[model samples]
Target: MASDQPARRATIHDVAKLAQASTAAVSRVLRDAYGVSDDMAARVKAAMKELDYRPHASARGMRGKTYTIGIVHPDLRNTFFPDIFSAVAEVILPTSRQIMMATSEWTSTEDVFAAMHDRRIEGMIVVAPHISENKLVEAARQAPLVLTHRHSYSTAYDTIVSDDDAGAELVVRHLAELGHKYIVHLGPANGRLATQLSFVTAKRARAYRNAMESLGLGKFAEVAGCPHYTFEDGYRAAHEVLTRSRRPTAIFAGTDNVAFGVIQAAYDLGIELPRQLSLVGYDNTGTGGLGPLSLTSVDQNPHEIGTLAAKMLLSRMDGRESVERASITPQLVVRRTTAEPFE
Candidate 1:
């Protein structure tokens, strides 16, 4: 009638000993593998129930699958990816799957891939990767793969991308609507175009150029050179663009962070925002809504993007091969940073 104390630190051997069976029999029962008789399995199950024994993960990994997914991102400090990750976690909450993560830091892709391999992840989601198309295809051979904000030229793995081109067009149209004829687009460096990564920054640059041409301001549209999306990069680019003899009446930035830098540069040079220069940015980060900045920008909806990418990855992992890519439409979030050109 007395309650039995919980077995301390349950192990496979302890379960086998309690069940009066071999270690192999206990493992077979735990895994529900073939060849174990009903009575034998029942005995082992009863022992495990009594002992509260759980199989070691390393041991479980040996058989075949672990139901784990890996995610590699280029930067974690940025709010965009963190928002996306939160969305992904929401989607994954109901599933038995687990996620492992790594950051690339614009360094060796091999190191990140190796880290994932060491964990024996069954699938992967790589965001804005720096690896080559051929290398991505090769990497996919190790696991089912999903790409976010990047594309694979191999057509082997599933990809989900925000419509950067469409987003760029929308930005240009917004500037035109604000009655600004002279606009400059501070763009990512040429290396972005040459890289084999699916999330090519040049795609947005091209969109910026096309939008200007379509609006009949091609002659006035110039792309300022920025090697990276940092505050200093934006500040320098904005300074050069603003100081020109024929200064741009308006400026569009590729990212919110870059726009912040541009705004700072404008203040440093004693230029009034929107009154002297209509500034717009992409990514729609929190700063866009600040009382001081009020930056008009495009909302890429990183949460929705991350959710779609996670769903795409899960579908592929669950054996749904046909759903290779998911495209989420973007919207322009208009705010105070844009206005009619000053006299």
Candidate 2:
């Protein structure tokens, strides 16, 4: 006769017993708690494998640690973001903590933050958040928070950013040195508000103007506003400027993605790159290095930024209270797209 009872599920106690370790040790192993030895971890993992043990996430959350880190970003379509994500993943690989990503593509940033909170994420890394400073500070109070690409000052959270001013200066000076007097900047629409806000786009735009003025080309300096950082906005802005009676000899795109659009627009308009018009973009994304594209860009060291953000988040999670602000220097990579304007 067969019994009607369901099979028993393995518990932490079972794992501890099988591994000849205490329940506390098993718990620490499960949490990836500090001071855990490799030998102990190996024994516990072996026991867990043999018993097919799986820890309940909800139960772990009840104890105040979910062993999960949340990453909140505006869009996943941006290639530069993936570099940061990969670097973060590599840093967190040796730990038991896992990553949970949430994008503001379909939902609001508030909703995404709420969902991450509901899941009890131990730490959070917010990339270029569009939320207000007050809301961001409030979220930081709820969990360990690290911000990337945002320059707002906050004592409650850590920040990792690139030197946007230096990056913009590099692009402007590079173009100016190439004997291009008429230079146009294509940046986010809100860049005009740089005087009021610390937004990255605004900073870059302001820096570009300052550089152009210092180089005695302020009269010819122009900025064409893009609705967003997408390729469509870039294309639209480029097309508008390119068709003008007094066209710029060079275009400084705010981002690599936008630069790609500028390239396509140039192709459609029969403007020969480097020969007729020069171009420079920010964010040295991998695709910009293609043999045909050969986009000149500013390298913000996104991988290093990502690594720093992860480490800071972990430090905050481990009870570090002091806020950290890390800024990475940008480098200009000159490619084939930029040259002296043809006579």
Candidate 3:
């Protein structure tokens, strides 16, 4: 007959006993605390691995350090975000800290922040936060905060962003030089509000208009708004604009994901790219560089942005007081998607 008793889970004490070390020594190894020796750390880690022992995050938090950093982003489908995330991981690899990621795809940004707060994350890096500045400032009071893709003058947190204005100008000027007098910009509609004008999409749209005006193409400049940055929104918006009587010879999409939709929509409509329509997208994602797509886009140096954001957050965690801001310049990578308009 088999015994009905439950198996006991491995604990730190088990780890210490297995490693022939005291509980205090095991604790020091787990915390990555100072004064831990190389040989002792190797023995303790091996013992823990053999025992399959995992530290309780809540218990670790009770001791005043979770050794976890939280990263928040709007969408996980965007490939550009992974570049930033990988860079951040590289910077934190040498430290004891680990990263925890949260996405606002199905919940509000506020809810995500609250969840991170509950977990007692040591620091936070919010990418393209949709929340107001006041709310952000309120959250910063609880933990070290760093923001990417947002331009705020608040001294409460550090900011890392790419120059959206310059990037937008680059796309518009490129299309204009390709003999595209009728050019349209497709971007998110959510940023139309007065308060949300600081958003990257809104800034890009404004810069596109300004660049077109400067090039004497103001009369032909148009902006088609997408409800979201998803591929479906891009496809729908493209259909509407491409079907118009005065169809734009060129379209500048707010993101590569959106540009992908435009490509599909143009294909469905029997329109040839670079002949009937020239398209450019922001965020030079890897998928966009595929042979079939070969999309023209602007590179915002997401890796550099992520690296800086992680460093800034770590600095704040280390008790840096003054606010800091860092910006990266954007570069346009022309591919096979764009060319001079065909007569």
Candidate 4:
């Protein structure tokens, strides 16, 4: 039998047309607005039911909802962070949520937070933010927040991290097992004059020093300051360390980026990796696995880190108020870059 109704399903506009009411009136009825009259409300409801029309919660709110989540990271170009971002995106997709990224660098900080505050985002994920934990906690009062790599212990927000100290110990133990005692930990600058601004790196360096001393190699424990996480700083530090009269048998780089710089310096100095110099990096970022580099490193499994952060954020958004803190124990990925020291 031929039907009189249109082939396509009814829409809000169709309901408005059939009920002889303005779209605003229909909107008012849907929102239970004060001014909508009895006749108008009844007409809108009848039309909606006749057409089996459903209202989307996102479409109508006192302030309106955007159904968006904001993600803020310090450096968008860093290889390690992107893997986390990819994992977060995959988790968000099934929920019909849109993911917006913010770089805490430059003017983007203002733009990103403005979106978080003004764009009506239900929640946010921040990685290695430069801001203090208290400031972050203050911000969390306004919205649900999940922080990664920021040393957050606030009961007001969620935090997830790969245990940096333990990860460092794993590296030191691995090197020790491989018969390397002359291990030099290359990271932030060393000594009373040394300064390391990020707690994550500072913790790793401390663990490295502690591990070395505990291994009865305290006299040989050396910390080379790279000034920063930048590759050039790493290269310069490595150059200084490797070009010495007594070079380290192994190097535990603070992070993979630093390791990349160290690797370059090794090549420039005509040193063979795992032959003349055994080296390892932290943060088994995706790029480190691509065969040519196949870096022996500590695996935080950024994908897992991101997934945990996302789950916590979503759960927090669902009105669970208790603070959730999670730590993923790290693993050592043995690759081409490490080997036993030749006698």
Candidates, ranked, lDDT: 2, 3, 4, 1
Regions of model 2 farther than 4 Å from truth: 1-23, 43-54, 189-195
**Per-residue lDDT over 24-90 for candidate 1, one digit per residue giving the tens place of the 0 to 100 score:** 8876666556698989988888887788766666765877776577889987655667778888888
Predictions in order: lDDT: 0.80, 0.90, 0.89, 0.82
The parts of candidate 1 lying over 4 Å away from their true place are: 1-56, 151-153, 192-198
Which pairs clash (backbone N, Cα, C closer than 3 Å) in model 1? 150-199, 151-198
For model 4, the superposed segments whose C-alpha errors exceed 4 Å read: 1-63, 107-115, 190-198
Instruction: State the lDDT of candidate 2 residue by residue for 1-343, as single tens digits.
Output: 8889987999999999999999999888887788989999999999999999888878888887788999999878789999999999998755767899999877888889999998889889999877888889989999999999978878999999999999999999999999999999998655334443467878888899999999999998777987467799899999999998978899999899899999999999999999999999899999998999999999999999999999999989999999899999999999999999999
By TM-score, who's the top model here? 2
Tens digits of lDDT, candidate 4, 1-343: 9999877867789889989998888877765556888898889988988998766535633455556788998775579988898899888854546787878766544456666787677788988776655678777887898989866588888989889889999999999999999999887766422344246777788888899889998888888987456677789899999999989989999888889999999999999988888989998877777898888999998889899999999889878989899898999999999999966
In candidate 2, position 118 carries an lDDT of 89
TM-score of each: 0.80, 0.91, 0.89, 0.79
lDDT of 3 at 151: 68
lDDT of 4: 0.82
| Candidate 3 lDDT over residue span 1-343, tens digit each | 8889987789989999999999999988876778999999989989988988878878888889998999999998988899999999998754657789999888999999999999889989999888888899998999989999876657888988899899999999999898899998888654343126668877888888899999999998777877567899899999999998879999999899999999999999999998899999999999998998999999999889989999999889989999999889999999999999989
Model 2 CA lDDT for position 16: 96
**Candidate 3 clashing pairs, residues 3+ apart or interchain:** none
Question: Which scores greater on TM-score, model 1 or model 3?
Answer: 3
